[model samples]
Target: MQEVGSAGTIAVARRPEHRGRSLYTQALFRLLTQKPMGVLGLAIVVVLVVAAIGAPWMAPADPNALASGAKLEGPSLSHPFGTDNLGRDVFSRVVFGARISMTIGLVAVITSTVISVAIGVLSGFFGGVVDLLFQRLIDALIAFPGLVLILAMVAIFADTDLPGLPEEGAISTPTVVLMGTIGFLLGVGGSRIIRSAVLSVRASTYVEAAQSLGAGDLRLMRTHILPNVLPPTITLATLGLGTAILLEATLSFLGLGVPPNIATWGGMLNREARSWMTEAPWLALFPGLALSLAVFGFNMLGDALRDVLDPRLRT
Candidate 1:
């Protein structure tokens, strides 16, 4: 009897180990068989992430530093992408701008993920008054015009500043704030999706078995429900980062975002909107192209991830 019980424990442990190995092998095979779009997207995303992370050290010169005579110069051997209105290197600003764009995307997405996951897991697991209240709250938020709501939030928080952030933090103050505000609102979508996923998972036989085995609610949620919900949530969160970045650029272009003195691709386009289109088209072209490519890469990556990770999309 004792030997039989020990064998049962060994089998149970081996089950999880086998599952882990299977998952790893599946992931490897998927990666090896990735489509051209997926490969290209991953490459571009890697480049963008590297640029964003290495911005400070990689910038040719001070992005904010102004040299009076260099203003409005076209791309040359000396000034590759030329200088902006204030004589700051456009290339430098754009490089540094990557930092800003990526930072906001990363930070806001993290914040959104945490808040949304909590709201979603609790709402789905409880499924009573707790669910009802959260559902209504999220519904109301969804009802608002997304961009308009973000702008309103930005306007409200325009005067508010974080006490601990360094002074150099805001290259385009308004744009960062707007992106964060919009990103938070967008988080609600993820939360709602997660809640629904959780609901479905709660009905699964494994969940019922766990409950019958006297596993507590918290344990069931953390160990079982959350894991099931994460695959889809990861896909959503990645795609959402691209959307948030694009929105920030749009807001910046409309003069509702970062300041002129700061250098972002969007800010650069806005500053040179009139003259750069004619005199130095590369000024607008390269930055705009980069932004589009960045968005496209992330989107393709999300699609690939869905195909690879989502059970619904799996063959």
Candidate 2:
């Protein structure tokens, strides 16, 4: 009897220790061990992140500076990716664009995840009219095309003045709008997913035991429920990053994302550049390639994460 009791106690003690190892560490380890595409994607993303972080020091020349002779120049030792129509080094602009893309992706996914998790948990745990109402509301919103919603928000808020900028065109507006839009959409979707996870775990024998022991709702969620849900949440959020970045870039390409002077991968591939694609094919090709690479990298990483977190998905 004592041996069984000691074993059970030891198991209980080790449970917390087992959970303490960082999920990020585990996920990264899994990613490293995965297929070639996963490693390649991680490598590409790391390079872009490094370039973004070191843009000021790494860029060969000013991303915005213009020179009459440098305009439409082909690839050279001085400007490896060549110069755009405006004579700005395409390499520098591409490097700088990485910062904006990464920022938007990270911010939007994180914000959405937090908001969605909170609502989903609250609704799922309580299990009453609150859940019903919130779920119904979210379902209605989900029915609308996301693009139309973002466009509607843009039209409504376009004329509104931002704090630092004038009533005229301000990049901050779209940045905020895009981040919130993506976050809200993802959060709503995530709520359903998270709620499902919560429900599945809520009925477990351990959960019932905790409840019988007089654990509060908040305690049950914080200590017992949230941890189990985290792996899938993280996987979803990482995947969502690529989508958020792509959407923001789309807005930028549509002339609604960022300011004119500021460089974005999408802005670099704007209509004006497309018009000259025949004359200066490199103009659209390089930025488009970079954007595609950014999306691809995130997607591969997300897939790796999914495979790592959900063993069922792994071969």
Per-residue C-alpha lDDT of model 2 across residues 1-315, encoded as one tens digit per residue: 012274454111112324546756776787787656778878878988998889888889888898888788888899888888878898898888888888888888999899888988888888899889889988899999988888788777776656775443324775777678888888888888888877877777667766766779888898878887787788778778888889878988998756667788888888436777887788888888988988898888778877877657866
Worst 10 residues of 2 by lDDT: 9-18
Residue pairs in collision within model 1: none
Q: Cα RMSD for candidate 2? A: 3.3
Candidate 1 per-residue lDDT over residues 1-315, each given as its tens digit: 012264463111111223445664685478458656767777888988999889888778898888998877888777777876668777777787787777777767776788788889999999999999999999998898888987787778667665654333463445556656866776887898889888988887677766766779998887778877777778778888888778878877776656555666677677674565786677787678778988998898878777877657776
Which candidate number maximizes TM-score?
A: 2
